[model samples]
Target: MPTSASQEALTPLRPYCGRFAPSPTGRLHRGSLAAALASRLDAHAAGGRWLIRIEDIDPPRDIPGAGEDILRTLERLGMPSDGPVLWQHDRLDAYAAVFEDLKAKGAVYGCACSRKEIRAAAQALGLPEGVYPGTCRGGTGGREARAWRFRVPDRDVTFVDRLAGPYTQNVEKAVGDFVLKRADGLWAYQLAVVVDDIFEGITDIVRGADLIDNTPRQCLLYEALGAPVPRYMHIPLVLNDRGEKLSKQQGATPLADDDLLGELERAFVHLGFERIGADSIEAFHREALRCWADRFAEEPA
Candidate 1:
């Protein structure tokens, strides 16, 4: 049994916390509004909790006040979270603790390769680009540790996406010894996300299909950490006229806080649900959720 202090450091006891984690790289665009609406509807429809998480782990990518702006936008859209918002930056200590545990278990090792080196090695091996070749896995040959990486198991990581259906990836061949911490000192997404999900007791993760590929990596982390993996649902991408995903980097416009109900109807249609006229924001949720339940038989969350 863990001591009281260590127990406090472990995952909190809770149930059914589903979250909408958005990187504050830019404002809440139309695409982001859809994700928030889906997560809120699924959580509420299933009598679960909906939480907001600011994924500001990459400081250099974060725009000034983008996270706060997203919160305001969610409030304006009538989709407020049911709990205190989680900011990744505030949970660094928690992530560091998990890192220490992994290190002690010998599940992770020092890596000395750069992105360029990995890409070059991948090309030479005729493997997919961006897949690390695990050159430094066997002790890095005494080279200075530039990063820390998990030693991926040879087996496959597989799971059924609630919307997109079954998926699989062999981490060793497809991704190879993925990073846990970067040389520049940022915690890797695979580590921070799994740690936060376990800590928050998240039961479901609903987001855009653009992240479908990353799910397997996260599932592998969940297994390594002895945490139960959550069900996943990767919804269709909101595409611009050019068939590109609607994103801040793609110049998608920020959502207007004043157009809550109107945008709600728009998102409903965007998700292929029946459009509803807003008598009130509350009624709008009822009608929209009815449409969702009709489609999914039950809300996945």
Candidate 2:
């Protein structure tokens, strides 16, 4: 059993908390806006705190000022964070602490294999591609530790998404021992995200559908650390002319500020809300909160 101090470190500050965490790679486009609006509305419906977190852990991919710009756009849309925004870059120590806990518990190991080595090994052994073959799980064998990986249980991990419904994945078979920290000396998204959500007491997670596959990995992390798993709802993605998910890498345009009402309307419609004749942000949110609650407020059966 953990001592009181260690237990306190893992406890959430609120009973219900939801967050919209956006990476600083680009400005908030329509796809991201819809997700942000949904998360805020869900929090409002649940009478919970909705926080905004800047996922700026990947400095190389982050635009220097994109994070601040995203927050400004959110404020313009009348969906500012409920509390001071948490930036992942500012919480390295916290991530390290959690990693140490996992390491001490024997739930993680050092991985010395490079991506090339893993791919080659998988091809050679006829293992499914992209699944680590446990090359370094035993020990580095005189090689340097390039990254830290979480050991996954062999059984299936199942969870019901509020919007997507029942979902399951065998993390060990599908993703193998996934990374907690990278060889580049930066924390992995899987580790940072789970740790942040746990520390913040996030009871619900609302994001894009593209991230559905990442849930099982995070679930494993939460279980390993004995933290409560948050409920998940992954909203649909906004597609572009090419029928591709609108993303920064896909050259998605930054949200135009001139027609905030029109933008919000489109986002609401994308989330399956009927168009409303709202003239202001306040009116839109008022109706949105009602619509969202009517649809998703009850716990999924």
Candidate 3:
């Protein structure tokens, strides 16, 4: 049998493909703008392709026309992505295909636990405390049709983040057998993202720090599918006075078209890029890109 290390080496290596996947829940706010600018700049600086994907898999929460508004904001900010945007809603069949493949490999099972049941079970078992307690791990939750969860083995999933450095999480304890498909018949973010990234040839993921904890679970799913994993960079999340992440739900002000230059300067400063002045948006973009390139070139690999 091939050694585990050698088996890992057999996995395919992909090029530098960075992407920004945003949910269509609302208009792009300051935090979202920072994330988009960072990801786009990183990809461009690395001589890689940057792409955008609409995360609209959850129909109930999606706001009408929010996706288009996000695209327009990015365009106004002068950071348009390459090629057509990929919408998650249009890739259901692809997610289903991977779900079936994992099921065939005996890596998944049907889950029949209600939210209340799982929460109670987690409290009783002294589990790490999450929504699901793996009460149906042996298929005995005593519930009806709901969803499916991938079986997480007793092992630690680890990865080195490009920005946040090295990290590890035990999938079985941290999040027991996470859902691949939801009870409402929609694919989970974990499943959909893994499938979509592989399909789109994505090699680098740049997003906010809120998703840092989710990296291990994604890594597990990628391994289960026998797919190559991408490098991850989790930027610092912008917070309000209440120490909560900035979001539309939190009443974060949207980026107005007229304030593009001001917003862009603030975003670059927030990201630690220097040499920006109170100038027109066009001049700011040019000067910022030049300064960014100079700083990046000075950094030793």
Candidate 4:
């Protein structure tokens, strides 16, 4: 069993070990830059390690040079990681090991339900308000291989976010039985991320608010795998004119190489970092680090 002391040690304000896990579906945009800078600063300010991980498990959606491009962009913006980058594609065996453990613990099962089938089942049950109903919990059949889903408990999984404050989600309702491995033979984000974060010994997770809901599911995975859950900080997302989050699927423009400094400044400001003079990228990083250290110096015990 884990102790409160161990949990307290994982706090974001403590010796920071943060990471920016970006998918390789497209080039780095303003949203990605903000997350990268925030995680880097948070780690560096606490004199901890800042690492980068490429979430390229979904090969179908990955671009050929997108990961390399993202690394180059981060370097140009003066946010180089402390160690070698972690490529999720190269860590399939690790994910599989955890998946097998979960299966042995009776915490995961397969579901043959298609997207259309799920939608129709949701409507038929008249409980389409929100959340998955876990129609195929027991088993659909052994005839065809389908997606694997983790079994959610009835109680709530709660966590405190540094920025968003307290958040609670009843895993059984909020996000029903979530996928571990997809029908396309790709390991789901929930499983891969949980395993990777544990493997990398990440202590703080700073990412877009869109992933805020994902924390609970990940927490449950951490518990099931007997791994420590990291502290989370979800920064506000960069939205478009229509109030939609900026994303590659929405055709968000990539950050231009020439405007690296300007873009980094914009990302810093967007992340609630107060700008304090200095023009160059190195100066920006130095000031940002100082600001963060001073800001967290008064954190309550």
Candidate 5:
């Protein structure tokens, strides 16, 4: 079980750990920078560890040098990870362990359904589009499995976000058996994330609200693995004029300069952080850490 993000004193944890994980599809946009700043602030405030992970699991979509470019941008922004950074590419073996564990528990099954077939099935079944309809709970013999999916129950997975408040998702109905490994043979985010969080002892996850829907599914994986779930806080997203979440796919522009402190200050203010007129970058960080610490600090038991 995980401690609630309810501001109560979290059970004595392994100190505290947080992370900034970006897919490296493009440079860091304002929205990405805000998430980075929020993660850094929460870690510093809690006197915890902050780390980085490059989520480059999909090789075909990866721009060869985009990962290094993201690292350079973060370095210029003055937010550095506490320990050596982790790369998803190098962690396949680790993920495989979790995959096998789920297989042993019969928590995952093979699926050979194509996107087209799934969509057709959704229409015929009258389920919402995009939610897979569990078309292949049994093995699709002869044809190799296109993907591996976790079998979700109809029961609800509930968790409170420190910032977003209560949220729930009944994975079975909302998103039927979701993929653990993609048809492209790449690892799925759901499986990799739960394994990594457990590996790193991550205590809290603070990210953009766009990922709020992903929390419940991840929680289900946590339960399947019998691991502790982390507290979550999904912050408001920085959207483009089109009302879409700012993302590389939306052609969102990346940080174009090396003005680390200036960009950091702007991102800090963008997250509704207040600053004293005379505070230097260092001063703002100091005070901001104190403020976040108080806001997230565990209530005295």
Candidate 6:
């Protein structure tokens, strides 16, 4: 079971291990850079290990050489991973093992319903739209299984975010029985991410607020697997002109190669830090680390 807030306050802090996982859909944009920088600063402030992971599981959307490009960009911008990069595509065996384990525990089941069918079932049953109605929970009715879904419990999951404070979500109502593996036979993000975080011993996850909704589902997975849930800090996203979160789909442009220090400074300010006024990259990082520790230090136990 997860430690309660009261219990957590009494325990010593764990060895800090953090990661910045980015999909290889395109080059790193300003928004992604801000996320990477914030994660790096947070880890450095805590005197922890900060690593990188290439979330390249979905081949259909992945660009050729994009993973390598992202790693190269980080290195050029003076924010390289402290450890070896974990490529999700190379960890298929690990995901498969976790899937098998969930199956053995009866925490996941075959789901044959298509999107259209699920919507129809939800309408017929008067349930909220887009939330799965557990159509195949009892059985697939002899229909060929098109996907595998995790059986979310009907209860509230609450967790504390370093920046966003305490939050709760009832996973079963918000997302219902979410897919563990898609109809196309690929591992789902929730399963892959939780398994990888466990394998890597990630103690903290600091990323963009765009992923905040994914936390509750992941927390449930951690409980089902009997693994400890990590601390999270969901920083504000760098939005586009339309106020939409900047993303590849939103036509966000890649980070420019010229003036790396200037670009880093912009990202630093976007993270709510005052201008460090450092002439060199090394000096800038040094000052940024000090400033980050001052502002976002962990509360006293």
Q: Name the top lDDT candidate.
A: 6
For all candidates in order, the CA lDDT equals 0.82, 0.87, 0.80, 0.83, 0.81, 0.88
Model 4 per-residue lDDT tens digits across residues 1-301: 2122224333554456789999999999998888898888878877899999999998888999999989988888888889889999899998888899899989998888888877777778775554667877877766464788999888877777877777778877666889999998889999999898888888888899999988888888888888777888799999978899999889889998887778877887898776555688899888888887787666544
Please give the range of 10 consecutive residues that has the lowest summed lDDT in model 4.
1-10
Two-way TM-score contest, 3 vs 4, winner: 4
For candidate 3, list the clashing residue pairs, or say none: none
Lowest lDDT sum, 10 consecutive residues, model 1, at 1-10
> Superposing all C-alpha atoms, what RMSD in Å does each candidate have to the true structure?
5.6, 4.5, 3.3, 2.6, 2.7, 2.0
TM-score (C-alpha) between model 5 and the true structure:
0.92
Tens digit per residue, CA lDDT, model 5, 44-76: 787789999998898877888898888888876
Q: lDDT, candidate 4, residue 12? A: 51
Per-residue lDDT of model 6, residues 1-301, tens digit only: 4323323222324788889999999999999999999989988888888999999999999999999999999998888899999999999999999899999999999998999999999999888888999999999999999999999888888788877877788878887999999999999999999999999888888899989899888888888898888888899999999899999878899987887788888899999988878898888899989999998766553
Provide the TM-score for each candidate, comma-separated: 0.92, 0.93, 0.91, 0.93, 0.92, 0.95
Error in Å for residue 124 of model 2: 1.5
What TM-score would candidate 4 get against the native?
0.93
Best by TM-score: 6
Candidate 1 C-alpha lDDT tens digits along 133-186: 889878888789999999988877777777766677787888899999999999
Off by over 4 Å in 6: 1-13
With candidate 6 superimposed using the best TM-score fit, by how many Å does residue 176's alpha carbon deviate from the native? 0.1
lDDT of 2 by residue, 1-301 (tens): 2111212222323466999999999988998999999999988887889999999999999999999999999999999999989999899999999899889999989999999999999889888989998999899999999999998878887767777776778887888999998999999999999999988888888899999999888887877888767778889999999899999989998888899988999999999989977989999899989998898645532
Error of 1 at 284 (Å): 1.2
**Model 2 misplaced stretches (Cα beyond 4 Å):** 1-14
Overall local distance difference test of candidate 4: 0.83
| Candidate 1 error regions (>4 Å) | 1-14, 298-301
> Clashes in model 5: which pairs?
none
Which ten-residue region of model 2 has the weakest summed lDDT? 1-10
